[model samples]
Target: MKRFWMAVTLLLTAGVLGACSNLGFNDSSESTASSGTKTATYQTTGTVDSGMYQGVIKNGRYQTSKTRGLATSTNTQSGTYNIKSMENGLLDLAKKQFSTSKYVFQEGQLITEATAENWLGRKSKDNANGLNPASNGKLDEDTRAPIYLQTLLEQDFMTQSGSKLQLGGIAIALGMNEYDYYQKVKYGATYTTHISDAKLVSEGESMAAEIVARLRRLSGVGKNVPILVTLYKNAGSDALVGGTFFRSVLSTSGSDLGKWSTIDQQNETLPTVNNAKPLDSNVSTDFSDFSEQIENFFPTLAGVTAQAHYQDGSLAGLNISINTQFYSETEIMSFTQYVATTAQKYLPDGAKIEITIASTAGTQALITREAGAKGFYTHVFGSY
Candidate 1:
């Protein structure tokens, strides 16, 4: 037993001397306020086909309250894949840059030798007119091409991680997001791809090793303790762009990757209250932007709050409550349509949206039972 302890100590000493610096496990570490956690930033440069991307990964440690004499530490990682280049002609550039067979450019947006045949497959005159290269406004191939690239890169990243790591629970899925500007590809001559705030939570052996090592080095309390990893994007940028949560165990799951669990930050029950006032800061982060947009639409808006309900990490439905002075039936209808369309973009397909409006007189309700493609109001019903 004495010899065994000595050998174990020697091995750990060697490991500390060998890789401590590379792991950034130095003594002088930055703390995350009250939590006894540390933060580390990781960067990787890689090429997808010919297009190069700079991947940024940020990690942080967290510990929730102890339960059954076990305190678990949660570690999170959030990432972004960015591409920049001086390229023109979106479709041509995509074909030259990416390794994909199906680079299908929607008709009426891009013109080619096959444009006539593609146009012939349309269903109606309006559809045909909509595809006219001259009539389609700026919805051309140059702009839409980057969207395809973004989608491809995002999927590849997820697949790569899935194959490499053993994650726990449900893996957090990335959302399809469109920025107001695409740097160069859309409105200008240059082309760039920016995919932001895809999150991965670590649960399993990967997280277990980290906690055990840290505990062994510090005070030796981590044996078999649960660890959480909450990867938050846009931590320093726009609040709305990137704050998806993927809760995974930090320890290894006796496998390559930790088990991951997807969480809807906005999925929660509303606190019971008597007043019909505006919701407080307790509003879920998911609905933060929607609340702000509504307030801006009506400066004198009384109160606004939104809650999202989820099942198995999938958005099941949405509930929004708003209090304002007064608006006509037409105005209310337009507002409901607008909200339904906007929320649908960020929500899963087939998810429902329920909107409740409270005016000075009474209350009204609206429901989009079937939010359409692009979140259009396909089936809307309203009642006072």
Candidate 2:
């Protein structure tokens, strides 16, 4: 596990250094094999350039999923943040259990787009294998059954065997809707029906069991492969942040799922507003102090905000954005230095921190501090 994190840190550091040197961050960097065999390389999905990394094999030409574009088409989430969160969040969780050193990552190849659409659609005479409950001819929230399953995501993990790679494990994420939005008729006003947390989890677990059974019946996926299934409750369209994964189950053998585990993860915007849940006092105080220090230095700045991620009730990462009006290259560099210093002073010690300095024109600088690292990496954009 330590080695896995170290590799990630090195990759991130290399990416930042490469970006600073005028080379594109996502540019391919490959390692050659002494035996003249193809080796793994870092790759990113072309669909979303969000900086999430995947390991590719065979000269970096890993097989692309047949249903490549289905995620955007089938996803019902209205917010782009939620869509990205659902996909990337699953990968983050899977990394904890499936170390990158041993297992290579690949996009899902078994489930086709048609199968995904059918599973997401309402069960009817035509689509008997649909996972969602059949809809009745009613629009009222009281009588109509809310659609529980919003979208399905799958990620495959491969293991190397002397120049060959085979499927070793699979991770699947189910994105469930917290509120069901529907219209009574065409061109009619849409109404939302809230689904309780208890109901969502109950439905998600049942769907997961059936999904495992179906996966076992697939051609490539057999009964013995280990599978991890996670359930995520998506936030509403108006939410400031994405939703969280509440529960997950692992199946190592057979079609049955193993004992479920709770994922105590949450995301909160810093400088709490609207009487949000109280954060850890130390973290909250540190962020408050950090914000104050920045504001004191540059009072004319538009605003300072942060999105903090928590895992198992502890701060895991923070992404801070600083909006300023200054554009001079030297001024931006000085401000970046000061911000990095203030962040080192006031930010929590164990969490990874990233600070982005931006102006009305565009992004001016970026500063990143790895978890438990002593120094920060600062880069001012343009010819600085």
- Which candidate has the highest lDDT of all? 2
lDDT of 1 by residue, 219-271 (tens): 21123322222232122122211222333333332222355444334234333
Off by over 4 Å in 1: 1-267, 270-285, 345-350, 371-384
lDDT of the structure predicted as candidate 2: 0.71
TM-score of each: 0.25, 0.82
Q: Which stretches of candidate 2 lie over 4 Å from their true place?
A: 1-54, 57-62, 73-77, 275-277
TM-score of 2: 0.82
How many angstroms is residue 222 displaced in model 1 relative to the true structure, after the best TM-score fit? Answer: 54
- lDDT, residue 37, candidate 1: 18
What is the Å distance of residue 182 in model 2 from its true position? 2.0
